[model samples]
Target chain A: GIQVEQSPPDLILQEGANSTLRCNFSDSVNNLQWFHQNPWGQLINLFYIPSGTKQNGRLSATTVATERYSLLYISSSQTTDSGVYFCAVESRNSGNTPLVFGKGTRLSVIA
Target chain B: GAGVSQSPRYKVAKRGQDVALRCDPISGHVSLFWYQQALGQGPEFLTYFQNEAQLDKSGLPSDRFFAERPEGSVSTLKIQRTQQEDSAVYLCASSRRQGNTEAFFGQGTRLTVV
Candidate 1:
């Protein structure tokens, strides 16, 4: 079993500000995804970056697989961004494995 | 369906009662998974199905919890003699493939065992 640790268990930011969340894994992973769980509890897919960088609107993520760390960036944050952000991954050597999730970082953006 | 669909968004069960949760994955998706999320925690895997065959179920917390996907498109998770600790949000997700693919999740079913 691999370990996934998310930083800043809780975060609060003013609207229009920027923030970065980090996730560190214990081993090599073939699948890495960032998700935003809204107030209604829907897990919205943010990015599927096992490596490299990807940007989606005010959200972006980068995963440095070699170092076993990933970063999620939210810019010009809005109140709607308030929720929990999760990072999940599966080991590269584990065949057809389910993604293991981090404890998640709760983000709150206030106007 | 455009996405995974879970039935009975919320359920309240008395202790010792049996309950079943249903998941309808996106049509043609090959991999279906069940996860349990406790309050203030991330989702934990319960079982996984690659088509009609269940390849992994090591995450199941107890023998009382069972899941099956007979035809491979829809799956059901059954919990027998539920206890208070069984209260959690059950999430269902599906991926296009069994490996190296992104998973789409349903809204989830919140179960409260009293």
Candidate 2:
């Protein structure tokens, strides 16, 4: 089984500030996704970047597959962005298996 | 029709009771998954189904936990003789394909076994 590690276990940012969350995996992965779990317990998909980079609004993510690491960037953070950010991965050995998630980065953006 | 939907957003069960959680995946989606998340913890895989056949269930913690997807559309997870440790959020997610696709998650069912 692959181990997923997320950095900055907790983060507090002022509105409009920028922050970077990182995820490191112990093994190669075929699928990688970033998710945001809101206060109400809704898990929203942010990015599905197995490799390369992707941008969605003020949020962007980059995955360096070779290095087994990924980064999520949030710019001009808003109060609505406050939540637990999870990074999950599917390894080559676990075909068609469910993803393994990291503990997550808890972000709190104060207005 | 729009996305994965789970029933009974919250449930409280007496210890030793049986509970069933339902999940309706997006129409036409082929892969469905069940996960458990404890308070302040990330979601952990529980089981997976591809259509009507369960391809993987190695994540299930005990034999008391079982899941099924008949007709390949809707799925149900049943926990028998639930214990306090079963208190957690049960999340259901579905993807269009079985491999290399983004999964859409349901809001999840928060279960508390007292």
Candidate 3:
């Protein structure tokens, strides 16, 4: 089984600030996604970057497949961004594998 | 539906009781997944179904937990003789493809076993 680890388990930032979250996986992955869990417990899809970079609004993500790591960046964050951000991946070496998630980075954007 | 939809957004059950949670995935989705998330923790995979076939259930915690997708569009996760430890948010997700693709998740069912 592949191990997914996220860094900065807890993060607090003032509104309008920028932040970066990191996720490291122990093995090769065929699919990787970033999700933001809102206060209502809805997992909102942020990005689907198995590899390469993508940007949507104030959020962006980059995955280095060869290095087995992914980075999510949030710029000019707002108070509504407070919640948990998760990185999940599906191992490429496995057969019919489900996404494995890291403990996640709890983010708090304060005004 | 525009996205994955889960039924009974919240549920409470006494110990030893049985409960069933339902999930209606996006139409035409080829893959469906069930995950369990404890408070302040990320979701953990429980099972994977590809077109009505349960492929990997290795993540299921115990034999008491069962899931099925008979028609490939709807899925149900049933827990029998539930214990307090079974209290958690059960999340369902669906993807358009089987191996590699982006997944959309439902709001999830928060289950509390007393």
Candidate 4:
């Protein structure tokens, strides 16, 4: 089993500010993804990065598989972005594997 | 469907009762997963299914927890003799591929065992 750890357990940012969230995994992974759990408890998919960089609107993510880490960047933060951001990874295994998620970084964007 | 859909968004059950949670993945999805998330905690894997087959269930916390996807389109997670510890948010996800792919998650069902 692979372990995932997220940094900055809590974060508060002003509207329009930028922030970076980090996720470190213990073992090599087949793929990784970023998710946002909204205030209503809905899990929203953010990004799916296995070993590269991807950008979606104001949010972007980069995964360095060899080093076993992934970073999620949020620019021009909005109050709507206030929620828990999670990093989940699928361990490289022969069988169908599930994503193991980190505790997550709770982000609060104040307008 | 537009995305993964879970039924009975919230449920409350007695300590010794049985509870069943249902999840409907997106159409054409080949992989489905079930996970549990305690308050303020990340989601933990519970089971995985590929089509109608229950491929991996090693993450199930105990034997009392069981899941089924007989038709491979819908899934149901049943907790027998529920305990307080069984109270949590149950999440379901689906992906088009089997090994490596992005999984779309449902809103989740919040269960409370009193």
Q: Report interface Cα RMSD per prediction.
A: 0.6, 0.8, 0.6, 0.8
> Which residue runs does candidate 2 get wrong by more than 4 Å?
none
TM-score list, all predictions: 0.99, 0.98, 0.98, 0.97
Point out the worst 10-residue segment of candidate 2 chain A by lDDT.
Answer: A90-99
lDDT of each: 0.96, 0.95, 0.95, 0.94
lDDT string for model 3 (A1-111, tens) is 999999999999999999999999999999999999999999999999999999999999999999999999999999999999999999999877889999999999999
Q: Of the candidates shown, which would achieve the greatest lDDT relative to the real structure?
A: 1
| lDDT at position A21, candidate 4 | 99
After superposing candidate 4 on the true structure, give the runs of residues whose Cα lies further than 4 Å from its correct spot: none
Quote the positional error of residue B28 for candidate 3 in Å: 0.4
Candidate order, TM-score descending: 1, 3, 2, 4
Off by over 4 Å in 1: none
Better of 1 and 4 by DockQ: 1
Question: Model 1, B15: alpha-carbon shift in Å?
Answer: 0.7
Could you give candidate 4's per-residue lDDT for residues A33-68 as a string of tens digits? Answer: 999999989999999899999999999999999999
Better of 2 and 4 by DockQ: 4
B1-114: candidate 3 lDDT, tens digit per residue: 899999999999999999999999999999999999999889999999999899889999999999999988899999999999999999999999887899999999999998
Give chain B TM-scores in order: 0.99, 0.99, 0.98, 0.98
Ranking of candidates on DockQ, top first: 3, 1, 4, 2
Q: Clash pairs of candidate 2?
A: none
